[model samples]
Target: MVSIGTAEIISTHDAYHSSNWPALKPSEKKEMEKRRRIGSKPPTCEKKCYGCEPCEAIQVPTISSRPHLSHYSNYKPEGWRCHCAP
Candidate 1:
């Protein structure tokens, strides 16, 4: 036995499906596709750390040569570290 709430939900769902929605224009569709493609790809870093440290005490390299830790979006020479780095 279907409940009143279930029946209302089913009717609403059917109405929504039956409703006419405006189709995207060719330009809008192309823009959306372009955005999706751009958004899906990873960002490239402009500058990379060679061998610098924020502080002399912190002898460890700010950016590791390791492939995993190599990519940095906001790498500041002054900070000597990536803003996103943990």
Candidate 2:
């Protein structure tokens, strides 16, 4: 069975504007990247259809220094990058 809870999903769109999102500390970045390299790739995003609720909400209440999103789907799109953990 495919697992969906390991990694936090993020969009390339949001990633590009690093300023909007808080920066990860050097150690945090290193660890996240390292885990990503060793684990599976992040999930792609899927947009909700007209009149449909979002597949999943993408933000959650968090107090961690590192920024995070609530949900992301595997809807393939060009020029987007995703990250997943094992």
Candidate 3:
């Protein structure tokens, strides 16, 4: 069993990630990894709302119908900078 940050990650099987879906594709794995990394960053209280501009512009995309990327969004935290850069 390995500890990530304050969370205790249990071994899903004899090996790490053994519980991961068998059909998970390479692209999905990479995206999951990227998100996992981002969730660990410290909050940016001073930065302006992403406003669909993406903080890093490396991943987050601009979607017309999607919810705005701001502290008030339902899925993200306030003061949390957008994953994608401007």
Candidate number with greatest lDDT: 3
Q: How far off is residue 64 in model 3, in Å?
A: 33
- Candidate 1 has its poorest 10 consecutive residues by lDDT at 52-61
Clash counts per candidate, in order, are: 0, 7, 9
- Taken over the whole model, the C-alpha lDDT of each candidate is 0.46, 0.47, 0.53
Q: What's the distance in Å from true for residue 66, model 2? A: 43
- Candidate 3 has an lDDT of 0.53
Reference-based lDDT, residue 83, model 3: 60
Instruction: Report the lDDT tens digits of candidate 2 across residue range 1-86.
Output: 23468975556645556446677799998997788674244343444333344343333232434334323544323332322222
Clashing pairs in 1: none
Please give the TM-score that candidate 3 achieves against the real structure. Answer: 0.27
| TM-score for each predicted model, relative to the true structure | 0.24, 0.25, 0.27
